[model samples]
Target chain A: MAAAEAAFELPPPTAEEEQWRYGPINDFEIESYEPSVASPGPIQVPTEGPSGAAALEAASAVVTVADGWVVNIEVSADAAALGLTIQAGLNEPRTGFGEDADRFDRLHEAFAPPTLCISMRDGAELETPVVIRSHHTGQGRACFPHAVVETGEDAGLDVVEYQTSTSGKGFAAPVVQLSAGAASRLRYVVVQELGEGIVQLGRILCNVGSQATATAAMAAFGGSYARVRTDTRLVGRGATGNLIAIYYADQNQVHDFRTYQHHDAPDTQSDLMFKGAADDNAGSIYTGLIHIHPDGRGSNAHQTNRNIKLSDAAWAWSVPNLEIENNEVRCSHASTVSPIDLDQQFYLHSRGVPPAVADRLIVSGFFGEVVDRFPGVGIQDEIRRLVAEKLDRRGANQ
Target chain B: MTELVITDLSVSVGGNEILRGVSLTVRSGEVHALMGPNGSGKSTLSHVLLGKPGYEVTGGSVSLDGVDVLTMPTWERAKAGLFLGMQYPTEVPGVSLLDMLGASFAASGIDASGLSDRLSEEAERIGFGQKFLSRPLNVDLSGGEMKRNETLQLGVLKPKIAILDELDSGLDVDALRLVSRRVEAATEEDGLGVLVITHYNRLLTELHPDRVHVLADGRIVAEGGAEMAEKLEETGYAEYASAKPAATAESRFASGGFDA
Candidate 1:
């Protein structure tokens, strides 16, 4: 009970905070929501291969969130061999919970019966990526998931998170924090494909230590209203970060994204590129900022956002901001929003390329810039196939 | 016989008349020269024949072997063996010249296999290098290169009727000779009907058209055999321009007769 009381204390939000400036806290109109009881459900662990159910068996940890509750938890022997610990349900069983439990804490207290926590020992490297899957299946319910990843000095880790749904009208609020120790490297990727009636708010925070590097790739394809926020802070000199995102929206859906690149120490570098395409009355909004502190000298940052509007009614808004307070810094940002050229269309059409086929080719070429930047050739091929499938579906529907 | 017959054609832009009662005929296996001063509606007539937007065909008919050409869409006209070698072709960035030619052939119902070989052979006939095949269509190309590129399209497309709009505008002597040779080859090999629109007799000297018509004040002021071109070269267009008043006459001097 004392532990629950200690962890449930709410922190006041400051008006001067930049992150909460446009937040919709007043819409919720709640001082706090009481934490619900944590009820564990049936755990279904598939024994198939990674291509099927068997791949989950090789994951360092697997956590499932169903019907606004964490129903299953699995940690593989490989993770145990690395001396990792799993933490979940930090507050209490029931009575000790209070109204001060915020949305994330409420989810942590109510639904998260077991939270998958992974830590790497010094000089240890995990060969397989840790998989965390959150499945929502309920009407008018919301789920909150929190993940904390930490790596010891000189350790390496890879994590892949998948957020999806079986069927339902619900919201998923997922928060992730990654801390990389000195000389450690981490590669993280998140794939979000929720239902059309679902609203998702995903936030990821990363802290990089000296000589460490981090790479994060995000792919968003489904949701009624989806917003992904990534905040990366380079806390040590000579640390590097790379962030890449690609999104496709169709129908009456809307996708919003906010990214921040913070350089807190000298000799830090970051590069970010986001590409998006909207069709069939869909819209997208992207806002990115690169911040360099006064003492953060010798920093390099570049950010680019490119969008394509397939239909006349579809629209996209991009805003890139750069705040540099130190000398010897290199920073640049560029954005473009325009319709496809009619001359290009006519040229392609003149060659007997049908209108739809021409449009698909142009869209594919439009998003190819980001896809080509992917590190692995296999990943690039897979992304290309996924993009082609989405384009085919959109073309067929039209 | 494949022929393009333009009779008493009048076209207007922004409600202002540019071509008034112009008449001419281009027969198969023969070349006809349309010589006129600047702003005399030579290029305007070509554009109107291609059915470009905003150019109103207020009067007259343009027909290809008895089919109405002005009523058809631009691409349909192009597919129906009517080609316009634009004086100033619009540059389309990111589109390769080879690809555009291949697509044009496919759109015109021509098979696409061996298309690159065909384009290359035609390009070689005109002394164009193979490196030119990879460049974007008309983007960053010189005026002479643009003309040759258009002629290359002419060779590959092999249109029955080609309207060469001022093909000799900015070419040097070497380029002019090259273009004239290609036109001569097209006429003999394909039995193609050609309408070479120009302002000078230099291109006509090498082209040697079957008939020459002097266009002035939006109408044909005089028509004669190839010697009419020589007369214009010797006398310039001063006499022809002065003799025409404000009269809107659609006159045709057939063989050796003049009604007026």
Candidate 2:
């Protein structure tokens, strides 16, 4: 453990930086939190625990991590026969984060516990998903959960990482690194539904190989001030990367997303879609960039960000940028921030739908398109339920 | 029997009067055709009746079954049995027809015990396949298909009165015939009163009207039996065009209407 003075000595990312412009950085005092210890066993939670969602029953394996430490792991008989190796307490030093790495990244690298690793052999295929439930608890505590998922050549796998926190003034920083081998298919999802008193800064890094397809999906609906930055690199020829995220922020919460889609090789492809809504006095910010390097000939990349504001006090910011150096590549980026459409409300109302119900339907439908594109199954219903719950709370507050 | 009454209705949009002293009534089991040339407040009247915002009811009274309608909200007007078949059905992405039907049913206090089956039956009658019910409401639907969807809603909602504004504008002859026959069926089976707003008489011959009224310069200029539709069709609304208020032309264009 580091000295208390040393923990406060490290600098935090400031609001002036491009990636942290819309973030509430000035209010985050690093001295207010200290590292939390790992539990010896699975932490006992109440019926309304921080992680209320049942372990995806269809999962081939279920793993639980608490306070940045792996607490439990269960592998199904079918998965064990198929030789799916999921082990904890594997320490891998973090490296190669590039120039964008900031103080938070270093802090996470220094403080996070042993990495939980899930590995698959060449040409191996898992029919069901492996779920990881990462929970954060304790007041004024900081926890960093690190995970690394890898698949061999021509292998197929699905992994889900669920992040949650008990209600308290805590800090969480989680990192996940995914490496998809050549000719492999890797699907990964991370859902963040933290408590209202927590502040979370997370990152998802993906590296796609030749002829491989990698998809990353996320649904964020919690946290007082939550921020996630995702970077996907298509480093091999003919590789494909798809990114999708849907976020809803209620109360005074703030949800921030920064995404980068990098096409570094020829014949690569990437498509990204992020849709979010802000209700009550909540706010959302999305900034995305699609970059095609000089050698990325024949590559195609598209980035789109859409947001809806459900109240006069709610706000949203969307910025999409493109950097294309290859003349032969095709790249496009678009962003939009608007309120629920009036014409749609009028249309519903004329059909005997009340105004409140019409707005609810519109908001629900706005996110429905994104929900349909999600690749996972067991968690899709949870996303819908959370969105509806948020809407119900908004109704009650009104 | 239900009755929808309009008394000396005057309305303005952006401080410019679009409807002036209009009076009309349609009782259950009656069909009334409201004929007018372009920019003659036909669409405006329909919008006002369904309580669409942005239109100021300067001096008017609209009541349904002896209850004041103008004082109620748009959904309340719909719940009070007023339906408007829009000329350009708004495209609402991500909202399915089935979802809309469920919400409407609940708002109108109608039982939705078997909404899916009822919707499937009504959709099939109008050639709107069952698959279409799960698709976004009116998104990418053909013009004829949108009209059919509207007609399907008319059949399902069974409102006491319906104001169909240019229901045949984007329809082909066969689609017009199909939609008209469906409307006639609703009128016959449920005593559904209708105020058909149109620029042409093509729809009149399909569902013959009990009374035909001509609107010129926001006022009802002529009212007669069904033969009046035939006479107006031959004359082509030329006299009515000549009588349009000169001062209203500029305001109409500013309000998004084509030049008369």
Candidate 3:
């Protein structure tokens, strides 16, 4: 409980820093929202709460957290027999996060609450996913939670984490640390669907080991101001890391994303694609870099960021950079920010599709490409439904 | 019983007067051929009718069945039974042809029950396989395939008046014949009024329009029967221009000849 007060005394991240650009550091004032208790009492888990998103329904384990407190944990007996472990918090102090650490990282460290860790043993193969659902209730209450996940050598697993915020003002800050072992495969999805009055800041650090493959997919749709910074480190030879995201921001909301793809070893590969749409007065910002160190010879990395503005007042900014020190490496980054394609509008309009309907179809079709790439996640249809609902809400407000 | 009537229609693009006082009419069940050489405002007329951006209507009146269409939006005009088979179709990335057919058919007030069978029948009628309906709209389609796709939309949409802009240009002989036959068939089956804009007489021969009007310097300079098109093919627009009186009056000319 004393740690929560001490964490607030720490200074916030300054806007001038390179990593702070377009971040919600200025929008977050912890004093405005009530901070969650350091130690919360056991919660009465609601039987019929926010549930059954296909991604969560297909999981073998479900962990539900209420206001930074873990109240429920469920794991299948079959998965338990395979040496899958779900525990609370790290057993030892961690190290090795240097340049990626910042003031936000320090703040989360000082106020870290009940931590949830999901790990799989060596050679374990899971056919179903493990889901973590975090619920933020209470008006103006602040919550800080930490999560850690690890995949053992030669093992494969899928994990999904979704955040849901109830009505009223609040703040949520969550930090996640994840890694894949040698020759392992890990697919992780984090979906942010907060309520309208909340502001969220989340940081994720992922490490891919030798000959391993890792994919981190995120879908962000809620929050008054939402920002995420993701860093992926290819630490071992021949590792592959893929980062993909799809976001839709409507109304007066703002979404920011900063990603780093670091290739530290030889023959590693990384690819990233982030696509989003901003409507009404909503705005989005994306800045990413592909960094290849001297030892990352023969590495290939590509970064692409695309955004579509759905209204006259909506805005989007995309900045993609590359830092390659190895002459043998191949790395490139590209970005595009524009309103819906005029050609697409004309084609639909010529067919007698009204202006609004035409824009809706084109926007849906535009985001469909990104969502279709993740059919394995089984959340594409749900994402589409949310987009339609958001568009309708925007229409009604206009 | 719908009629497309244009009176003293003038348009300008980027402050340049491309179309000056153009007037023509096409009633349902009738086909009118509009011919002109390069820079003669034939395409401009089509765009202005569709109210495409960047083209200002300096002076004009366009009506469909006596309803003023000049103030209507492009989509409303389309729903009001006006269709333009564009000379250059735009490529859209992710929208499939089936999705387009469903939305477009509904816009035209068609009952969309069993839309699959209707889309298949329309694709087949245009010499396109049913699988083509699953493909994205005009993306990576060859020039011939794009033309066929345009005609396919015209057939299913069943517009009262279709302004086919240079359907013969940039098309191979086979594609040109196929597009021509499809438009002709659609006209007969849907009771469509056709306004075919072209510079070549090849399509004019196949179309055999009820009326042929030659546009020059943004105005119709000659008006006559189908043979007028064949005569212009022989003399070309250069000789046709000098043969005319060069007057801006609303003068009517005799068939196969101009009053200079």
Q: What is the TM-score of each candidate against the true structure?
A: 0.67, 0.94, 0.92
lDDT of 3 by residue, B1-260 (tens): 77999987878888877776778889988889999888888988988788777789988799999999989988988999999999898877677876776787676667777777877787777677676677777877887788888888887788899999988766777667777788888778778999999998999877769989999877787888899989988988986554542324542332233223
Better of 2 and 3 by lDDT: 2
Q: Give Cα distance to truth, residue A124, candidate 1, Å.
A: 8.6
True-structure lDDT of candidate 2: 0.85
lDDT of 1 by residue, B136-255 (tens): 677788888888988888888888888899898778898888888998998998888999999889999888899888777677777788998888888888776645522234433322
Q: For model 2, how does the per-residue alpha-carbon lDDT over B24-84 read when each residue is reduced to its tens digit?
A: 8899988999998888899999999988889999886889999999999898899889999
DockQ of each: 0.17, 0.75, 0.59
Better of 1 and 3 by lDDT: 3
Deviation (Å) of B160 in candidate 3: 1.0
Q: What is the lDDT of residue A89 in candidate 2?
A: 72
The TM-score obtained for chain B by all candidates, in the order given, is 0.92, 0.91, 0.90
Name the runs in model 1 displaced over 4 angstroms.
A1-141, A147-163, A178-191, A208-213, A393-398, B1-260
Candidate 1, chain A: TM-score against the reference: 0.81
> Candidate 2's error at A47, in angstroms?
7.8
Cα lDDT, all candidates:
0.73, 0.85, 0.81
Q: Model 2: how far is B224 from its true place, Å? A: 2.1
Please give, for residues A178-281, the per-residue lDDT of candidate 2 as tens digits: 99999999999887888899898888899999999999999999999999899999999999999999999988999999999999999999999999999889
lDDT of 1 by residue, A1-398 (tens): 55445444544433244543333323332223333234436544222221124435456777665544566667777777885555564432232223643444444444443444556777788776666666665355666566667788888887766666645667666667777888888777776667786777677778888888887888777887777778888999988888888888888777778898999999998999999988888988888899998878999999999888888898888889999999889999999877875655644543334566656666766676687665444445546666777798888998
The collision pairs in model 1 are: A48-A53, A48-A54, A49-A54, A49-A55, A50-A55, A351-B103
Ranked candidates (DockQ, high to low): 2, 3, 1
Instruction: Pick out the ten consecutive residues of candidate 3 chain B with the lowest summed lDDT.
Output: B251-260
